[model samples]
Target chain A: MDSRAQVSIEVALVAGIAILVAVSLVNINFERLNLARELGEGGEAKMVATLIATSINTVHANGAGFELTLSESKLNFTELTDVDQGTGIILPIIIDNTRRKVIVGRNMSRTGHKGQWNVSVSMVPNNVVRQDPTARYPEVTIRNNGTNVIVYADSSKVRVVP
Target chain B: MSSNRAQVSIEFIILVGALLVMVIAVFPYILKTNELNKALSAARDGATFGAGIRGVGYQSGSVEAPPGRIKIKSVILERLGRCGNLECYRFRIVIMMPSYYSSNSSYVNSIRSTIRNQALRFVYYAFNGEYPASSVIYRVNTNYYSFNATTDVEYY
Candidate 1:
């Protein structure tokens, strides 16, 4: 082969290697983007779960009495109303004492896909209704697409409600 | 012939151009991996801090705010998950504490109230997201008391 042909062969080899590297990098980036999205969703799920748990705690604290009844498709809070403090400022807001279903993809839409988000929330109450124990924790289970993440939060610690 | 040599050089140039295109296409993936690693580290740190605070609250029966408060915040970028948009994650740190009205309460109700108010300030500083100035409202019955003292967060 002449010197010119040799140069052409060398260029072709270099170009091929560069293309391969570039393709690999692109794949890596796509993977990373997906991870970031999942993390964001995970964060959202945790936030929602915390909100629900704290709401329950607030109801228990302000109410004359309340009951958490779990059903097959829903979790209900019965008798969930605060008594009139007589001061008449409506000290605590009266919450709806009804069973709320834990539906995952009820209102949220998935981006770039035909499938919707798989959402589920479960509550596990620690036994501290009658007694004033230092530990009163609620276990929350949030699931998305068969992947379940469990978070245990202590209402006393977070003190999200007044 | 000199013409043949010129043709060879042109081919070499074409090859080089193709290689450059490939590199440009792949560079994003490499950068994304680095970002993903950073996000994971931050998330783990926040999770650890949250867990630690809860542990202490459980053991000691009460936790105060500001100096004694434990706050954790984590963020996730758009490059990590299957989703394509950027998303921010925030958690309200929960610690086990003695009830304010209970006997031998760790802190006075006034002091606990101050702590609760300050926790949000710390959370705002930790995460880069928008939190609504107005408190989010929820509907509950008249029987339960709203804590409203825990951490509050907003993400856009």
Candidate 2:
């Protein structure tokens, strides 16, 4: 009602509005950063998936007796909170015969929430062996066994002995 | 003196009210613009990735690339029979993206244009300097957010 009271109220309202704006701006910035991070992770995962798909398709195209070994390291799985802890333990590649696609990313099973940052690429070959990695540095062997293409991950098979 | 002071106070209140009204009017526009920008970014990245995949497939029949917000719907390759001594090939690739809220289609159109150019380049190389007859057609179905490229090669 009084002049002094009016000025004090005005100051308080202005200060409150300024604080609100500041907080809102900060929150918006944080959201933007998180979105960027997610996009980057998804892009990386897709790249890895594409690489595996290309290799498998190439081997199948070359036909039987055409074998090529692809080291897991070539995939270059980037570390993310959603993926497995480290390189040695994580099995990062899966060939889905039913879907006729290849998925590249480790599944996250922490905190009872299961999800994986992965990408799937459709392939030409339908008959392909499904093999899981057993060793740390496994090399994937893609072979077209006349009728079906075989894909298996093995560390010891890095060198073939006659 | 008291009337003058009252007049100044009333004017201040009116000014603050007008400022509030303007802020409210522009807020939604700002948010919409932000959303449009995000959509454009995603679409740009997706287009680049898809073009890379098309390039790889042309070079070695193997495709390698990342998908940001676009997904490859299907890839079809038709032999188109034979062309004299050389072989003729026709391939179609479809990429799906999310639609944007804005009506300005220029952003997406530019991306589509870039993809068409890339397809032409791939076709030129596939012809292998023989100058074989080639056609690169691009169709953008906005309703389905699908971008399709059908490339045909026929020897002259």
- Over 4 Å off in model 2, which ranges? A1-22, A76-92, A104-118, A131-138, A154-162, B1-156
User: What TM-score does structure 2 among the candidates reach?
Assistant: 0.39
What is the Å distance of residue B65 in model 1 from its true position?
Answer: 36
lDDT of 1 at B75: 32
Per-candidate DockQ values are 0.02, 0.02
Residue-level lDDT tens digits of model 1 in A65-130:
333322313321112111121111111211122212121221111111122222223333321221
Runs of candidate 1 exceeding 4 Å displacement:
A1-12, A64-112, A123-162, B1-156
**Each model's C-alpha lDDT?**
0.33, 0.46
Per-residue accuracy of model 1 over B71-123 as CA lDDT, tens digit each: 34433322222222332332233333334323434333323332343333223
Alpha-carbon TM-score of each model against the true structure: 0.24, 0.39
